[model samples]
Each structure stands twice: as structure tokens, then as C-alpha cells.
Target: MIPVIKKRIYLGLLAATMLLFAGALGYIWLTFFQQDGGWLRYITIVAVVAVLACLIVIGLGFAGIVLSLVSEKNITFLNKPMNFTFSLLYPVVMWLGKVFKITQDKIQRSFVEVNNQLVKAKQGKLTPDRLLILLPHCLQERECPNRITTNTENCTRCGRCPVGDLLPLSERYGVHLRIATGGTLAREAVKKLRPRAIVAVACERDLTSGILDCIPLPVLGVTNDRPHGPCFNTYVDPDAVEKAILFFIQGGEGNVFHVSAN
Candidate 1:
């Protein structure tokens, strides 16, 4: 199995563990209140039942996500619910990772991987004009005087940064590529362009956040490599970006293009 799929299975297990842990605590609470009979007991029962129902829904959502990962296509009806459940569970999963002494980046990267798979499973044909390649501003050389945040076309193709390569590729593909300095600007670009699909590149944290934030919007995330450290002169494979572009532009039909696990 692919590493990302394994991580997703592990993530699903973690969510199940969280539910079991909650159930255990609830059981202990009920045991402590066994001797009491009053409105408090009724409230406790209601709360426990409610929690149980939520757990059931979340479990189904996890199953949906897992099934989508293994299947060729996403279950159209479950997509929104799965994404919503993921959004609800993300923070809790991060906390669980901490309890288990797992690095946040690892979990975030796993989340991105699973998200990418889900998005890819839902892939459909899109005109190049309707596609967007959203990139983080950190991909730019820090020392460069030119700022391409507001307008990527301002880039002079100096070859010092990935943007130099990406710009020409975007032009060749006739897709809109925008470099965003932060989340606010990124959202603005999304809002203004209203692309049907997006190919986003960023670190684990931002990519995870962006995936959650752009729920119901297909986003194929390619994690950037942070060589110098967090957010400084990060690098992404331009070829990966192209593959993502092809995945969408070609409608991802019949193995014409494959979304890589990297």
C-alpha cells in the first residue's frame, strides 16, 4: 500500500481511538452517577447518547474517506460530509497526535495526502481558464527585490526560484497562477478568480489549513520542501505541479494522468 494510504488508515484508527476514549470516560462518569437519580442523570444519559450518535456519524465519515481512498471515484453524496467530519476532527486528531507523541507536521502531511487523494478521486475535466495554481509567496527568493505576490506576471524569470519555472508553465497551460503572501490574499485570489479547481503548493500546516478551508472545492496539494527552514526559500518540484495541472486539465480519465503520492 502507499504510505499516504497507510497514514490515512492510521488516522482513521486514531479517530476511532478518540471515540473509544470518549466512550470510556462517559462510562466512568455514568458509573460515578449510578447512585444518583434526578434530572442530572437524565442529562447525563442525553449527553452520552448525543455523543454516541456523533461518533456514529463520524465513523461513517471515516469509512467514506477510506473507501474513497481505495476506490477509483469519490462517493459524490458523501464528499461534503466526509470533508466536514475531517474538519471537525482535525484539531482533535492533532491533539491525539500530541498525546501519542507524534509530530504535528507528520499528521498534517498525512492529512494533506489523504485530502489530495480525495480531491483526485473527484477529479473532472476543467478548462484551463477555470483552473488555478495557487502558490505560497515563500517560494520566491527572499533577497529578490521584485515582488510577485500581487501579480505573478511581474516575475522576470531570473531562474533563482521555482516561480520562474512555474510562470512559464502556467502560461503554456493557459491556467491562472497566483502567488499569495498569506491566507487572506490566497482567499482573495480564490474569490476573485473563482476557479473550478485548484493546485496548491505549501508546507504541511498551510496545506492542511487550505484543504480544510477550501472544503467542497477540489484542491490538489503538493507539499513544498523547506530546505533553509520553515517558510524560508521553500522549494517545490515544478514537474509535480505540472502533473497536478494535467490531472485536472485532462479530467484524470483512464489513467491518462496519475496524481503522485509525493
Candidate 2:
């Protein structure tokens, strides 16, 4: 299946859920207001109107996100609000996906795909030094005695895993490269480096959560391949990582991965 198809499915589910919720509210207003109790009726009307207003704002934010996916130029104004809307609606979307029996990983991967498009739409050129490449600890060979989590530079350039290949890319591009053992370490690395943008490599779950956690900071996620199992010995495409790096530093030019809502 096309990767973006899942994202479109997610969006469709979200829209259907919102429509159903609004229909329920309308049904309540129509059924309850007919009895006419006085102040209670007024209060109910006010509450329903407020909820509808909130939904309208959410709908507008959703539209902005859809627009960003198709737009080639960065829509700078909607960046923060779109991030906030994604954070707000993610749980609801996940629940909806569960109702429809969609695997959470599929939904998460879809979310990441949509998010990458949104980030690409809003991201501008940055100095290479301001870009950070975050790698999962699993990228290192499982048996390697060296622990690169503390310091990625500890790797002796041994070609045991993708880490060795990535290290040279970092050096060549003059970008900050760090290995994160988990979410906590990833957050800490972001805090310490304070990068303008990030190119992250991880599984679907981690990448989705990490993107949401780092609000307003553009991150292009490259999902890793789990050949052996979950986290034991994962691998990521070094070419995807390089393209993501170039996308940020060159502002959506030069072999950047492109996805659209269309």
C-alpha cells in the first residue's frame, strides 16, 4: 500500500468522528430544547454553542494542516497552531482508530508521514550546524563493546553498523549527531543542543511521540527497519537520513522526499 494512504485514512476517520460528534450534539439540542425548561434550557444551549465553537476552531486548524501538506511554500502563520491541534487531536484519533480495528503502529506510521509533509511545508533553510541528527541506540551493533549513547564520538569508525556510516555524514555536513537510548535521553539531547531542526531515526511509536513532544521544532522522521526484533538490532536507511539532512539545510531542495495530501 502507498504510505500516504494510511494518513488519508486517519484523516477520514477523524473527520467522520467529528461529524458524528456534531450530529449527536445537534440531536441533543433539538430533542432537549423542545421540552423548554427555562434557565436550564438556556444553559444547555450556551454549552452546546460553546462546544460547537471549539469544534469549529479545531476544524479550521485541521484544514490548515491539510493545506500545508499540499503547499510547496511554507505557511509560517499556521505552524504553532497546527502543532497544538495535532497534539490535541492525536488521542482522539488513536481512539477512533482502535474503534475501527486499525493497528496502532499503522496509525502511528500514518501520523508520522502526515507530520513529515507538514514539517516539510513549513521548514526553511538552516545552517548545517543548526541541524541535529538523532539516532537510536539500537543502530549500533548489539555486540559492540563501545557505548555510543554517552558520546557518539566514542565509535572507533568501525563499520559494524549504520552508526559508522552516519558518523561520517555528520562530519561531512557539519551537523550535530547524537545517540539517544530512549525518549528521556532524546529530550535531554534536544535541550542541550537546542537545534533549530532535527532529523530523527526511530521506530513508528518513538518517532510519533518524539515529534509530538518536540512541538514547533521541525523534525523529519526516518523509520528504522527491525530485521531481528524491536529494539535489539534495528537499521535505518542512511540515504533517507542524508536526504532529510539536505532537505533542512537546503530548504526542500535536492532529492528531498515529498508527500502530499492530493
Candidate 3:
């Protein structure tokens, strides 16, 4: 939902930053070669080299993003480099997006999409026991008295919310399932369970941040539906969750449980 004007502004600023660096490098080179200096020439050369190296890395990172979007085949080699670059650049990109008055939700959705691409590029698979289904507490109905954060078995399977359906899904798939109220609890669950892979459900912001936080863990993020509001009475497509689980379990072999990039 980012405005076209804001996106243009951000791109303009990014281009300007790149040009500024290039200009600085050019000035350093000119100073190093044109002047008959000793240590200063060495210093300028080192600075120019460093700047050139940074520009090359940034170029590669952007190229990875483009390849992930256009290339149909798996580019597994780009996974780690793209993730590392994205993690390092996200804050600055977000700041510029904000300065340009871009929509926060749009930025977050883009982040999630990039994260998803990076994860898919990894092409990793895990067994049911090594997979974890991490659910946000908001998926629970506000009126429901069940406290399934500690023990999901406390649910009565009343079908009032996703929790009821998720419980059976976890059991059927034999994957670890836990409900976390916040990032702290989610991290704790991840630390304790130590699953090789994760299927996480949350809002756009949380999902984006969580995916970034759990890099190299191969998390498939499934966004939740917010019917009532942002946090309360939120719901997730149980089928989407199932498909994500099956994706890791089955390794994207057949279309029986195919998961889209939603």
C-alpha cells in the first residue's frame, strides 16, 4: 500500500546515496593519483578500495533480490548472503521509507516477501519432529477462557478459533506447537524447543521482524487474518498453516499440500 510518490522518493534517495559514495571514491582516487603524496596516497588508496568493496557488496545484494524475484530456479547459494545483507540494510531502508512517507504496512509486507524468498532459496527440509508451529496468542478468541500458552492440550477443541483446529493439526503432523504472547515468549519457545524449522503466524510487522530475528532457521511465515481488529479476535487460515507444515514435511514434492507465497 505504499504510495507511488513515496516509493519514488525512496528510490531517489537510494540513488543519491550510491552516487554520493561513488563521488567520494572518485575524489579519493583523483587525490591519490594526481598528488605526489606518500602516506596520504596509501591512505586514499585504502579508502578508495574499501569504498569500492562496499559498493560491490551492495550491488551483489541488490542483484540477489532481483534474481530471487525473476529467477524461477532455486538459487540456494544466494540465501545466506541475501539474508545477511537484508538484515544489515533493513533498518536503513526502513528509515528512508519512513522519511519518504511510505506506508509502514507496505514496507513490512515487502520485508516479509523478501524473507520468504530467502527462506525458499535455502531449499531445506525437516521431519515432523524437527518442525515447530509457533502461534501468536492473538489467534485465540478473546472470550475463550483457555490458557494454552503453557500447555496447548488445555484446549477443549470447541472450534471457536484457530487454536482448536491448530491443536489437531499439530497432533496429526506430529510437530511441536506453542502459543506465544509476545516476542519474548516466542524466543523462549524457540530456544527451548530448538526446532530445525518453524511455521510462524503473526501480523505483518511481527511476522517480518520474527523472520529476520530467526535467520538461518528456515521459518515459513503465514500471516493471520484480522477480522475484528489488529490483535483481538484475529484468525488464521488453518489450511494455510497446514500447507506450510506439509511444505517442510514433504519438501514441495506434490501439489497435494502446495503452499503459495502469500
Candidate 4:
């Protein structure tokens, strides 16, 4: 398994991350102390500080998300928002890690252990045919920045996406890739698909849910490469996608690689 935080590296990153918040505090202090020095100056300082604080909050949230990507560890619990819900709030459910001191490394190891169970299931140890794959349309035309969702009408089955590639693999392996519309759709779709194993692909956004929703059903996350943006000209790491399929179908012989934001 890939080392999750490389303790030393994360120590440094943790420090850098704290600085963003610190900057916000320090700026507020400096401005608050200087208030009444000038109306224009006070307004300028506060405005800048407010904007900086907004950015810091976002930076902190994104940093946390990237942290999730670094470690595929099982995050069993989460938290309610701090009363300031905004863009992509549900993903913030992971902030419980901060209070819980969750280690990303252990989470990754846990996933491997779970997948190993599925591997055992594949060895005639259990004859289970049900298998579900989450194929979030993290795909787009090679040159176009349009994200294509699952539609026989739109995709044209041109094989331009992992979804396209997954179609034939599903036919050959008898597995289904649920092209979910969103996190909610993915959750419901998985319930209906009800496979014995799951091979899920998503941006880091839906990964943990993809893993958690299919409890005991061995789920693997494949974060698609984002040369542009989410769903916009995006592509699943083909190697990762294929390996997930292979690992699910072929057992111990198949490789299950780790997700890395670095």
C-alpha cells in the first residue's frame, strides 16, 4: 500500500495549511487595531481581509478534500457543517477527521484488506455474480471541454470514455457500471445495481461515498485525471480503471493502485 501522509511531509503541509488561517486572523487583528486611522484605509483593509478569509476557508476545505484523496482510508464518520454551508457541503462530512485525529494511512490499508475479502470471494470461495461499478462521467471528448454523461444518445458509444470502455467490459465480465448523475443518484443507482463487488470511478468528491455506500462489497476508487476541470475534458486514469476491473474479476493477479494528488 502507498504511504498515506509520509508523516514528515504532512507535518510540513499541516504547518503550511495552518498559515492560511493564521493569515486571516493576523490581517483581522492588524486592521482591527488600526481602525479609525482612516475610513478609506479601514474599508480597504476589511474588504481585503474578508476576501482573504473567504479564500482561506475555501483553501482549507479543498486542502481537506485533497487530504481525502491522498489516503483511501475508511472514514466511517463525519460532521455537520459549521452553519455556513456553501458549495459542495456534503463533502465536508469528512471534517470529523480533524476532531478524531484520523490517520489517512490506516484508511488505505483497510480498503486493501476489504478488497482482499472480495478476492477471496472470487476464488470459488464464494460464487457471487453480482458486481457494481460507479462510472461517474469523468470523461469528455479528447479535444472538447464538454463533460459527457451517460446517454446512449449523447455518448454515441464511441468508446471515448471509460464509460464507453466499461460497456464492453461489463458485457464480457457481466458487471454493470452505474453511470450515476450525482452523488445522490450514484447512491441510489448502486442500491439498484446491487453487485457483489464494486469498481467506482469519480473525482475525489464522490469517492468516499462510493466506497462507504457499498459496505462489505469491496469498492475501489479511481480518481480521473483532470487536465481541465471536473467532467470537462476529464478522463479516468485508464490504467487505474482497467486495473480496478482486473482486480475485481481476476483476483490477486490484478493490481490495485493508490490515488495520489501529488
Task: Count steric clashes of candidate 2.
Answer: 0
The CA-based lDDT of model 1 is what? 0.81
lDDT of 1 by residue, 153-174 (tens): 6888888988898887687789
Candidate lDDT scores, in order, read 0.81, 0.82, 0.75, 0.51
Weakest ten-residue segment in model 1 by summed lDDT:
253-262
Clashing pairs in 1: none
Q: Which rank order by TM-score, best down to worst?
A: 2, 1, 3, 4
Model 4 — TM-score against the truth?
0.48
The lowest-lDDT stretch of 10 consecutive residues in candidate 4 is 78-87
Structure candidate 3, residue pairs in collision = none
Task: Please write out the lDDT profile of model 4 over residues 1-262, one tens digit for every residue.
Answer: 5434333332333334445455766776676656666676767677677757655555554444334334543222211111121123322322433444655433333333333332333332112256676676546466533344444335546655555555555555556656666788777776676666667776654665555555445666666677876666567765566566666665533344543211
Question: Candidate 3, residues 61-84: lDDT per residue as tens digits?
Answer: 656655654553356666555565
Candidate 2: segments with Cα more than 4 A from true spot: 1-6, 255-262
Give the TM-score of each candidate. Answer: 0.89, 0.89, 0.82, 0.48
TM-score computed on alpha carbons, candidate 2? 0.89
Candidates ranked, most accurate by lDDT first: 2, 1, 3, 4
TM-score, predicted candidate 3 vs. hidden true structure: 0.82
Best-matching candidate per lDDT:
2
